[model samples]
Target: MSSPTRVYVSRLAGLPVYAPNGDQVGKVRDVVAMLRQGTQPPRVLGLVVEAFARRRIFVPMTRVTSVDIGHVITTGLVNVRRFEQRTTEVLVLAEMLDRTVTVVDSETTAVVFDMAMEQWRTRDWVLSKVAVREGAKRFRRRGQSHVLDWAEVSGFAQVEEGQGATHILAAFESMRPADLAAVLHDLSSKRRNEIAAALNDERLADVLEELPEDDQVEILAGLDTERAADVLEEMSPDDAADLIAELPTDTAERLLTLMEPDEAEDVRRLLTYEERTAGGLMTSEPVILPADATVADALANVRNAELSPALAAMIYVVRPPLETPTGRFIGAGHIQRLLREPPSELVSAVLDTDLDGLRPDDSLQAVAKYLATYNLVSAPVLDDEGRLIGAVTVDDVLDHLLPEDWREPDKPEEDHHAS
Candidate 1:
């Protein structure tokens, strides 16, 4: 019975749950605990296990024989019903992780990344340590993690009652990511990190892209390395590169290592370009199709939900040998023009071949002027051989033209007083 004295909920999740006869049962999906009368550690209730066909079942801790890194042993009998959360229960992974609460001893706030439960006696458990991280807006990841005793925590009552991060974020679901980012900017750093952690990778990436560089770095630091990498993958390559470039060299390399090779390669290529150049402002993934593609094909590509409005606004038509560095850039096709043409008409028919594109090394000022002169929201960026490498959108160009801290809220004017 030499089970671990304490365990992190994340480590417990996915561990095999076995029956008394050593027959493998379901896997741990989440840990369940109930709020207590006071600050005393909440009681460990059981494990929410996912059995065959992804069916979730409740295995009370009363039946759990032992819990180790790889396995959770339980009494042979399991409640084979759909697992549901009781009003008094809290699902650690779903309800508590990444929450911001005050550390009593420190009198400052910290985010909960993991919770530790200690075995008080045989089959008896209590919430014990919390793996927390705390820092100001500018702090780095070098030395921010700390383990706070359960007694040192307060304000988690809101989390136990299910009125926490998830609830707060739901209110912003209707807002665009950029608008949400603006709202988050006005909140405290802890709140920003909490919401960022609660968001899905794609949504978080969109919001992060809309945030200031300093905020982006801070929020990314709050996430575990794996999660941060996943969020980076969801962002456009140019935006991802910009964030990574702002991070410390070591941190940047580590995150890049965690990203998928294909995604990492795209960001790396963008990173090689100067931030003020067209290459830096351009997104490699755009609505691109062969010159022979029909208006129907162009429309379908533009209609993809994944493409941002700017990216979907115009379609780049390429010559033969279609690839990343697409063969000789033939011309660009506007979405409006494509819609006006018959669905059977080839994209080449509506293509505007005379419009010149920016070279990778073109200056940001040149890019802005080109967009303005051409009345375009996005303009293509080409390589030496006139290959379409990417496209720069007006949003990207405006990001460069505005002050670095433009997303930051303006400070209130100081009150003038007679001396």
Candidate 2:
């Protein structure tokens, strides 16, 4: 292999992994290593490459022909199986960064910010150096930085308890919630909980929704009841309800009680329906406006950064009591139509009343057919009294239509193919 003698593992993160023919394959998410006994540096195992469909697979270090700041060149062959960390393996980025270690010479404890690995013999690569930061001196605002041989640090071999997530979070701060969820899924339970606790309520809530049900329940259980409720409040009502449904009945009720009454009410209403029904899949919160609201108002509501594209594609026009289970549903206005109308024109003028809204009890198949037949991204779910209750998006329908274990890792492919 032809590559740099040494490269910091942190710097390799997110670097594109390409095939020998210059075709882009995946991006490096993390470096795996096998820790050896005594003071010997850990042997580099492979690169965790996140490929199409957010599938993370392992690329053995031997398959890598070159490594640089811009990209990693692989020999075009890699296992398509989901990368499952074995008992003796470790994810360098997820586990090692931010670890507190002691500098042998000074006997001072410092936090690991990054570590470098170097090619050893013909094909083997091993962790070689570590970069650490010492506590700030009195009156100093910053800590001292140091880079030493792997042998000079003393805590890598032992399992960390209460390890901080500062460096890891900072390194991947730009990752989307879904990508961050994938990273969290691959971490040890202890490490995962530690990172979850460090995240703010809104951030954690977004991440939790992207995670699998079991992981979401586990992380929520790890948090205090008050904080858990706060996090639940941040999640979308539909997602929050689904996660809460997975918990023990008593635990779920306790957390719901701790949440704000309004938020809890929305989740409670969602919980009333079967999990696969329109009511269960819909988000209680959507772009809702009174009939008198203008095109400008509708536009602004849909422009909310928090609103998903499907949810923003249509605005619900309803009577007074502008919350979920609102007063009589008037009609829905397509965003495309609203854009063509005069800004001062009332949203009611362009409403699409041809299609009656879906009922909460509507089956998942019925919901799917409704959206597909009309070519709509979202449709309103109404109550028996004709009040607008929630809006189910195409994405929600797709989620339910896919296999129940769609989010879980897939079994290894029968054949390994080169790009």
**Highest lDDT model number:** 2
The C-alpha RMSD in Å for every predicted model, in order, reads 17.0, 2.4
Highest TM-score against the true fold, candidate: 2
Candidate 2: which stretches are off by over 4 Å?
Answer: 1-3, 120-123, 136-142, 413-419
- 1-419 in candidate 1: lDDT tens per residue? 55787888877766789887888897777778987766788888788776764556678777777888789898787767656556677777656776777878757777777888888865588778888777554555532888888778887787232224754454345666876676566555765677788799999999999888889999999999999999999999999999999999999999999999989998998998999999989988888899779999999989999788888899999976665578899999989888788999999888999888999999999999999999999899999999998999999999989898767654423211100
Model 2 CA lDDT for position 228? 99
Candidate 2 residues 275-364, lDDT tens each? 999998999998899989999999999989888899999999999999988999999999999899999998888999876989998999
Q: Going through the candidates in order, what is the number of backbone clashes in each?
A: 0, 0
Q: Which residue ranges in model 1 land beyond 4 Å of their true spot?
A: 1-164, 414-419
Candidate 2, position 68, lDDT? 84
